[model samples]
Target chain A: MAAQTGESASTVLVCGEVRTCLLPTTQALDRRGAAQLLRLRADMYVRVSERPIMHVLSPETLTGVDCRLPASDGSRTRAVGTVIGRAALTEGRLLQTTSYFGLPAVGPDTRRPWGQYLVRPGIVEPFGMLPRKATAAGVLQGARRGELDTGTIAEGLAAQLCRHELLDRRAPFASAPTRLRWVALRTGGDRPAALTNFTLAEDGLRTVKLRLPPDVPASAAAGLCEDLALHDWLLTHVQRMLDDHPFDRADDSRSLAALRPAVTHLLHLWMPRAHVDGALAHLWDTLEAAPGFTRQWQNLVQRIRDQLTLLDLAQCRRAASSKGCEE
Target chain B: MPERVFRESTAEPRTRAVPLAHLSLELGHLYMEDFQLGPKRLGEHFAEVRIWADAVRARAARRVKRPRISTCFLIDDYFTRFSTPDEVIPTVLEEAGRAGLTIDYLARESGCAVADGVALAESVAHRLVESPPPGSYGFRPPASRTGWLTNGSRSPASPPRTDRGRTDWEPPVETAARNHSIFMDVELWSDDKNGQRVWSCSFLAAVWQLARLGLLRHLGEPVLVPREQDVAALPPDWDRLPPLIKVSATKAAFSAYRTCTLVPHHFLPVENAVRLVLDQVDVDTAALAQVAKRSADEGMPVPPEVAQRATYVFYEEPGDPIEDGKH
Candidate 1:
């Protein structure tokens, strides 16, 4: 696998995007159905684990691309090779598709035949020397037309899985899916993997940039991002579930009714770093230190619980008053 | 790190290895029109294909020591079934024999769609990774809406309704163009009269290419596995024949590192579509790794790309004397 493609061809830059959403099934697929749904290839294993959640990760697949590198400095560098897309099911309630690839610092000047890239699965080799920093910024900033955008490839798989007949097409709630685009630049200099910048881009796009130890597997970086993305998605959903509701302004019970799904489907899914490889667990510490993921999550959790308590008290008062009037 | 805390046994991947050949030479393909044109047309088709098949064998020999080669033919029992195996198999074998060509494996086209209870076509459809044109920008292309696979960016379609947009014509652009665009979009499947999904000829051809290239698999098992049938006599019906019948005692594996199909000129577009579909597919990673390791160890390293492994020689279709009679 390209992940172990030696130090010389060791990833100079590792970047990926993950799309997370509630699986569009009226009822979330059970462990059995989740395993079946993620069987993208029969020859590959659909890894199912019950350690944390009934999680299922489909065998990783590759998509070949030969297009302009999405460079922030707008250098017209062309990259050629495959991008890896893996579908993951968390507790059979949420589906996340992550499309990712690593870049070597330099590659052949000309595009090799496609088989050359297939053997190297997820390695997207750039023509000539790769400007690692600029390329990383460019990808994180965004891709223009014809640029190699890993997020689009990720979205393609997510959309495809959502359309399967196995799904009832009726999501439990009408919530926008979140896109988390992450780029990890190899910190060749002595620096343990550190989360650099995590930006919440417009339209549910979250971009996380990391400086990782060169020796860490690119997949470990992706796993870290997926963990961050899943928790981030949970926060986003809960925030939306309580947005501008007149919980304090009115005696209406609709706000409480709307927030109930948040308690049921999402509250328990904030287990950040649950599936993240232990080696990369320290990266979550960086997140917790600054814009603390758990800090904001706990705040949101407290607010929701407080609101629910208020609603319950109001409902009891209203019932008691109504009964006395009727007597 | 004296002791490990916890480990889940299920989160592992394993790829079963399949036997491989240096080359898979497709003798030719027969469709309803070819079958309707009858045995004489079939004879002429094989005669034209025989020359190309010999050339491919020679090329394979030059590349590798004792290059294992397998020859196969596909019969279109999917799109429009004209005759049964009882009527068709004997003549096909006889014609190929007269042309001094041997088809080690005889496969039904429908088998590419569904063989031995596996939805192989649907599996491949899930694998279609589109060649992203410049400026893809994370926008998931609407492949689901059209069921079409294109080689490059399509002309901006006339907005679905008049109220939504104005009529402005845009030229379709090929992503890999040098000076001019030869953009092609292939429709892989459509609904029939009864609303049952029908896999298109081009899509099935793409799956056939994957099978020949030794890329198609379902659940760690080889797909379209050749079933040896002693040809005492042809089966009573088309359904009676095994999806893939091994007609020869040849030792070469049916799947190979590379494929060369002797298709008629009319199939050029279909094969082109196959290229588009194959280009985007991220084939199973573990399986891909095995192929790469096996080939490298064998000292006959194959191209890493699934699409590049496929080759085609399109000849003029044999004119139907029956059509001449109609004229």
Candidate 2:
């Protein structure tokens, strides 16, 4: 038998994609509004966390998948199960949708009854033995024709939420949505979860690789990746705002107008590892040390603050000079 | 340590677990035609179902030492309303009693669509996640939008080749077919003359099956809760009848870990459509897990797939000797 016929709790691989974008609303939503907006399932409650930040999470939903597993070495492996997806809104400003599924090393040769798969949500079992490393690499690199595509699922969910009546569909700024494709391979419990690689590809696509402890579930790994995605997006977005050179104008008034949304909407959303599982939270330390997500964010934030200060001084001087002329 | 452990009710949702039996055996379905044929026809139907019910009980006994099995009867009040519940209930119960069968639960088919103000059918419809076709890279419009759920890839929308160079005809192919295909596309719902969405019989059947499997939940609460009203108090109006009533004195639960249905041979097409719909529904995972855990604790683990957990016996329709001969 190519695949085993019973339940297996240990996950061999986890693959996911996260799509992050500013909530397309003129005004940020309050806790109550956020709840209404993220109500994806009428029968399930939308989780709202008040402390740390106003983070709202929609109930996990499943999308059934019965397709070829993406293998970088070009091997054809069929997998059948459901991929789980959930939408999260941070501080009612940033919206993110994550689509993910864990894979076991082996599965039954034929697709079992759908009810069996339904019971094990977010698990996509492959026929026979799973090519773990190649599949992981395949997820990060990209899916081929007829291969499972988590990015599209994530993007589709984000689009669906954006189209919700609660949202005005009018973003405060013109910024592209960021896509983070991630893969986590199981490692022994002796080794704690660690971030192995982070790559920023073209066209808003970022990839992260991690070695997660067996005890840490795929959902935790997904949570860690989502945190990384949100922070990285904040840095990228603010850097682009800095590049726009709102201060290039003769007077900094226009610059202040241009940057108000960032100060109002995006800056405070940079709290990293806030809601991530403690077991996998330390993975952020590696990114903080090297590329320094916090360091870059702090710099942009200071620059924005200085610009606001400079803008204030200019206005004061102009008022003083006008008063002198009147005397 | 902080003095307070903050909590949000929405954040920590709970699923109310339903008491589960080892098997929920459906005795038979009553339709308007069967009612018009009178009590003798109902007696004959129950007699045929009695033989299969015994077989189902024997099968359940093999799985567990002491199997808790419940029998349910569904009366068709949705598609075509017949006599009032007051008239229908007594006669149906008497016939089943004559055949030495006891129906623990009596349910109306309309109850599957909407039970106690909960739109069970629409909620289940929203939960439908279409099985991805071979080349379903992702983000195809949901199958629910077209009001049809299919098991395979439908032929392309393009018509036959023409002078203008349109594409040629293609055949629909089932996703899991080995040698050949038996493609099925079942309609989930359609608009009525008044433009109100009418849930299809097959779709409601799928919902009924999910309820029997103890999988339907509304806002983390159990749906289709059987009212403990006395059967003798059944109302003259079908509208006033409870969706489900505990008719028997036995303590067996209405829902179960698995279900075995004894239906008539002519209803085979409808049941097959039910399977097609059930295969695609993404049921509440928490409820599914509860059943899995409870069943495992009892030393009778169910198959993972919701559809696989259901078994059926398609006997010839009672008093249809000519139809049996033709077959």
Candidate 3:
């Protein structure tokens, strides 16, 4: 399959962007509804997993491209190929879509027939030698005018799916969508895939870096990164929920309203590496040990629970005091 | 990695494999005009097709020790509804028989549009990822939405603000041209007077080619499955007929790793457009991989590109007979 094309030794770099947001429907879709929403190709199945959580993955689709490579040093390199994109709905509420492609160091001086490029779905071949460092940096920084921008493709897929008739385009709560830009550089030998850097930049943009082993496909790396992005977005979104409703609010219902959605829709979605391939799953440990994704999530869950408990106790005391005054 | 016991059938999607022939040799395509000319004209078409069909078989034999070859013919029912299948099938068979050419399978052109309740053409249209022109930067509207496919960049609809001084029309340039350009823009489909989408001949031809290559599927199941029916008692209406039928009791399968169509020179432009569509289509990767693996197992690996796997012979059109009063 074309996905294996990225797994080949020829692929020197793989990069992508992931956009995560709440499914805009008033209520989360059930398994059947999620399948209907994500049936991107009528002939293909919407892969549904029920183990850790109900996650539905749409079939991979391609977007053909012929444009200049994004280079930090500003060298103009024209490339031609397709970028692969797919959407996933976790618990039928968290909607995420990713667009990615792999690149070889060099290609034929001329663009081959489009059929040749189609067979290698996610590979964008440069017309000549690749400027690896510059291209990698440029992708992280984002594409300029006339340069390839993966984020657009990712956002496009998400928006297209969000517009499906099955979705009313009304969210249960207001939350900002998060964009994670990631790049994976090929590494030789038996060394395992490693997360080298992860940066939370301004404007809801997060950049991730990884040293990927040769045997690990770019898609697998992409899956791992998507997992990271989904969890990161969850934490960030829930934290924002708490921060928005300050404790000093005269009405406790405002805080309860802010945290209710998190408890209802997000608390159980923190299972990292759940869907990642076993070979690349270990990469999550790097981030887990440092910033501690699960650690922060647990803390948020605790805070939300404690807040709910306090609200319940205050209500009980008021009810008891009112009964005594009536007697 | 440690292994535990947990399984979900829906999560693990599988592609059903189809029986394959080494070469699927197309005899000739039947249109309303060709049939209108009567049996003599059909016989003439077959005679010319037979010459190339034999050559293709001989080439396939040389590639493998034992080549499984199938011959199929297409009838145009979508553009112009003609006589019943019962009335047409016999004449087509008799004409091919006169030329000593056996059509192993027979397919209606409409089958490419929709087969067995699946919107094959629309699904394929969605799969099209147009080749981006230089400086695209993921900003261009996709060709699928525009209902047009092109080999190069279309001339600007008057220049943008960046080119305020330019008033003259600039020529469209082929993205893969070498100092020269042969640009082509094909209308894949159009809306009819009733606002119904009318699939173009070239787009259907491309779908036909994909079916021949065994790269199409419906929910992980093979599509366009050729049904073995009693030709003597075939249906009178075209709608009652299956998309594809096995006409001959031949051992060869309906589809093959490669296809060679014996068509007239008049169809050159449509076939070229078909190539354009095939080049851009992202076929079912699993189906593609199955063909790749099976072909490799037989030591006759198919071409990596779907378009490359299709070959054609653009022969001269058969002479039309003078109209007789015996209509």
lDDT scores for all predictions? 0.80, 0.85, 0.88
Quick one: best TM-score, which candidate? 3
Ranking by lDDT: 3, 2, 1
User: What ordering of candidates by DockQ runs from best to worst?
Assistant: 3, 2, 1
Query: Lowest summed-lDDT stretch of 10 residues in model 3 chain B?
Result: B318-327
Candidate 3 regions exceeding 4 Å error are B159-166, B320-327
Cα RMSD, model 1: 6.5
Number of the top-ranking candidate, with DockQ as the measure: 3
Question: Per-model TM-score of chain A alone?
Answer: 0.94, 0.95, 0.97
- Tens-digit lDDT track of model 2 for A179-243: 99999888876877789999999999999999877777788788888899999899999999888
Residue clash pairs of candidate 2: A3-A107, A43-B219, A115-B304, A115-B305, A115-B306, A116-B304, A116-B305, A116-B306
Collision count of model 2 = 8
- Model 3, position A203, has a per-residue lDDT of 89
1 or 3: which has the higher DockQ?
Answer: 3
lDDT (0-100) at residue A48 of candidate 3?
A: 94
Per residue, candidate 1 scores C-alpha lDDT tens digits across B1-327 of 346567676675444678998888888888777777767788878877887887887887787769899999888888788778877777888889978988899999889888888999888776655555544444555684678877677776563435657565678887667789887878888998999999888788888888887777776677788888776677878887889999999999998888888888987877877877787675765567667778889888777677877888998876653453574
Q: Look at candidate 3 and tell me the lDDT of residue A299.
A: 89
Taking all chains together, the TM-score of candidate 1 against the true structure is 0.76
Q: Which ten residues in a row have the lowest lDDT in candidate 1 chain A?
A: A1-10
